[model samples]
Target: MFRVLIAVGLLAWTGLSRTATGADATDAQGEVDSARRDALLSQAQDCELRNDYADAERLLRKAAKFPADERVSAEILVRRGDCFMKRGKEHRAYELYKKAIEQYSLYIPFEGVVERLRAVAERFASGEASWFGVKERDMAIEIYELIIAKASSAKQAPADTLRLAQLQTEGDQKLEAVQTYRDLMKRYPKAPEVPEARLDLARLLLDLAKGGDGDGALARQAQHELDLYLQAFPDHSRRAEAETWEAVANERQANALYRLGEFYLRPSHSSVGAARRYLHDVVREYPSAMSADLAKITLARLDQKGIQEPEEAGQPQAAPVAAGVGHAAVVPPPIRPPDKDLTPEKAAPPRPAKTLQAADQVEKWLLPLEDLSEDTGEKAK
Candidate 1:
């Protein structure tokens, strides 16, 4: 009786296990329906490309019914957005585009999305298509920010970060480009892209300095980065260019100092001594540079105005001490009359001064006969 009961319990357990396994398999199949939905969505996108908006919408609606994965869902949203845009429903299309971007951001292969967005931006920039404009480019930047946010965890972060910084530079968002380059350096110090990123960051900072919005600190940061690039990659293919950029960075810094000196030269706030020191620094530190030349001219002008050179200007004469109640004031002895023996020497007669008239006669005597005749006629008159 005991053996029979054990056999009956085993049979019941086996049946229950098989039932649970079948349910799990069914749930898994339901979850994996995304593959089928993705295929349908691809087909719908094809139809939409052919201007078949009605069929595209129908297929998209069907695809949306499945439990699609994030990638497929993002693609579907983008396709639906495109479909709406084709139907002249811009507001709806914008909404879907935004949703698609948000969904695409969560996917692992975010770099691929970045590539597509870059292509779109390039196409729009080249005038090849009007469908993707500044709005799409801006979305691409947003996506790049997301990728950079995950840089510490992503293997391809450095490359994507570099591309994003390049895009920022191309977009003329220089400050953003600088920050992105700095981020790349911090996150991937040993990355191969670091040298070029440093170069670019330095270049952008130099550009900011040229734009007249830069301060001493900004110029110094640029110079430091350029110096680091040169030291880090002495044999790089763009080493010469990098060196040139370094020179530019130095000039920018020197220029900042030169401008500060100029500001101090104003009569309302005259700091001639300070101005002379700054200008002298430009000449000493960057001798042949353009700013140095300007500094030289400025220094010369200051000198003409009787503003002493930096060396002499820095040394002030000692001030006279005033007489005080506690100190005795000493007075010098009165001058005695000159002694006759000290004034006894007599001088010889002085030579006569040469006048212009006498010099002209001398010149006439030294001239040749042809010139002498004219001189003689004038002299006779």
Candidate 2:
């Protein structure tokens, strides 16, 4: 019994000693981790204050190397990436953000790592730039392209395509932008972006029309796109803009048609039939639109010969008039000019207007006008 008691005591003492040693080891590790973390944080803060992003990044990398908790390690990687970005090392920053995403993916409880990744992605989307002159425009395009390619093989977000289209438009890559928008309509017909895309597309088309693309073609295109936009997003935030653009496009098309009709009576009538077709379209299809109202006024002017036809065939008729004669004949309409209320000084914007407004937009375009038939008795009403 004495021997058995001695053995039991020895075993208990050994067990207790082992437990103490284990606790000491754990406490030592905790202290080391805490010290390392504190040192890294201090170094980073110092580097940032001194504007030494390189040193800050180096310290962050060392902190990431420590076999600390996974959370701490991931956080260090993110901090390192942020420092890299601050230093204009976008490629390096992207790599670190990618690393953080991967590491967090392994232990994080979120549905996917996209939210964390998106934190960085949003900077690109919001148009941030790196010190290296790498703008978010480039990154956003790359990400959008990647998402589009991926969606083909997986459940890609429709929002990705929309973002790409928006970036392209903002970057002045119009044809590609429109194509991508069309792709969104085809691929994710039900996506929320589809309606917004349509609205944006319509506005772009109207701009094209006013910029002097074929008025007939542009008017048709704008009307079609605007109809689609209105159908899809009648109450969208930009609905008023869409409506206004739609009206402007139609008005332009009508003016083109009326001008063409007047040209038909000219001795040098070139494209008279085309002008009539345009006028007919304005009167028939856009009956309730401002263009139609202008069309009615034009038809009456032509009928009254307030715009007399150019003498035909040199047969004892009046001498040929100048090209602007027709335009001069018609009384200026009552439409309010955009800046009519402002004085010259007040009308001047901080910068010269690089873009055209609804009223003055047609000045730059060169679309063909239709010839008028000298006898259509329509009124402005």
Candidate 3:
């Protein structure tokens, strides 16, 4: 038993000794690295003062390679970046700053690091041409992304998020831009950038929905987003443009509805009610859409087939009162084919000059709706 206890004590002592020796070796190596790093940094500083940034950067890069000195490595990167900045090498400085941020441990960079990153990002984002009308848009995107990712708590982070999205768009990274724009709004709901992002996103989605081969889902999304913009920023400076986009969204949706109605009306589907429902909705909900006239003509064909009008089509929308505003509301009679023996000229209601002018206006509006019957018989075939 005594022999066993002595053996265990020796084992413990040996373990302790080995641990102390390992610690001492680590300390010794750290001192060696620190000394080398300091020498490199001193030489880099001297080169910087002599306006030899090329050499200063070289020395700083060597200092950054020393092991077990993450703090100094990060410092080295910052110093190299400063040298580049002093020499007006913003792109190179941005690269070094990015590395410094990644290597950050005990060495916190000055606030200027984030500011410098933003300046570099904006350089490309602002469309500043390079020597040959070239700009590093992708680099700008990276810098902005780095700023947002590394310095998210910075006051300009939200703005950087917006700029990143814009740069992504310029770089033809639409899907990525979409996600970034969404992040901007979702992450900073109350930010001033939200409204602009919302509007721009809506426009981009709408553009995607263009062309017959485009995705209908994009159109639907645009409609919803535009609706939100209209409701949220009624008095916004860009309200008119938003309204125009909303109209386009409505037109796209109406076309979707019309096509869906056509699908239901096909012989294989033969869903009369669904056809009528979608067509009527297009005509009622989106009358200003170009497809509304198509819907009306198609509806007439269904009527001619002896299919009774759907209960929902009972109320015909009111026609315009006149060419000008401020006129009292007046629902014109249903548009029917003009009688061969009767002309609109003869059917004009006789009244005062004002009434006659109003009749002329209603007849003008009625002409287009009346002409649908002329095309209906031909189109139905």
Best by lDDT: 3
Error of 3 at 348 (Å): 70
Model 1 clash pairs are: none
Model 2, stretches more than 4 Å misplaced? Answer: 1-56, 59-91, 98-127, 130-136, 147-156, 233-238, 270-280, 288-290, 306-381
List the candidate 3 regions with Cα displacement exceeding 4 Å. Answer: 1-76, 85-91, 124-131, 211-215, 264-273, 301-381
Each prediction's TM-score versus the true structure: 0.55, 0.52, 0.59
Give the clash total for candidate 1.
0
Backbone N/Cα/C clashes per model: 0, 11, 0
lDDT of 1 at 351: 82
How well is each residue in 222-308 modelled by candidate 2, as lDDT tens digits?
778888887877688888888887778767666665665555545554333334444565688668777677767766665676543
lDDT of 3 by residue, 1-381 (tens): 999999999999999999999999999998998898889889988998898999998998888788745666667777887787777677788878887777673475547678877776676665552555477888788787777877777777778888888888778788899999999889889888888899889888887677452336787777778888889888888989999998888888888778877876776655566677778888988898899999999999988887852354554543443443212222323556865656677676767654446546664456564456565654678
Question: Per-residue lDDT tens digits of candidate 1, residues 1-381?
Answer: 999999999999999999999999998898678677778878887897899987897899899889866776776777776676567554565566556555566753455544444444344344444454434445456555654564446677787788778878878677888888988899899999898898888878777776574345666777788788888888998999987887777777678668867876776545566677678878988786799999999988877888753344435422322422111112222345885553326544568896667547665457576654555665778
Model 2 Cα RMSD, 1 decimal:
27.5
Better of 1 and 2 by TM-score: 1
Sorted on lDDT, best first, the list reads 3, 1, 2
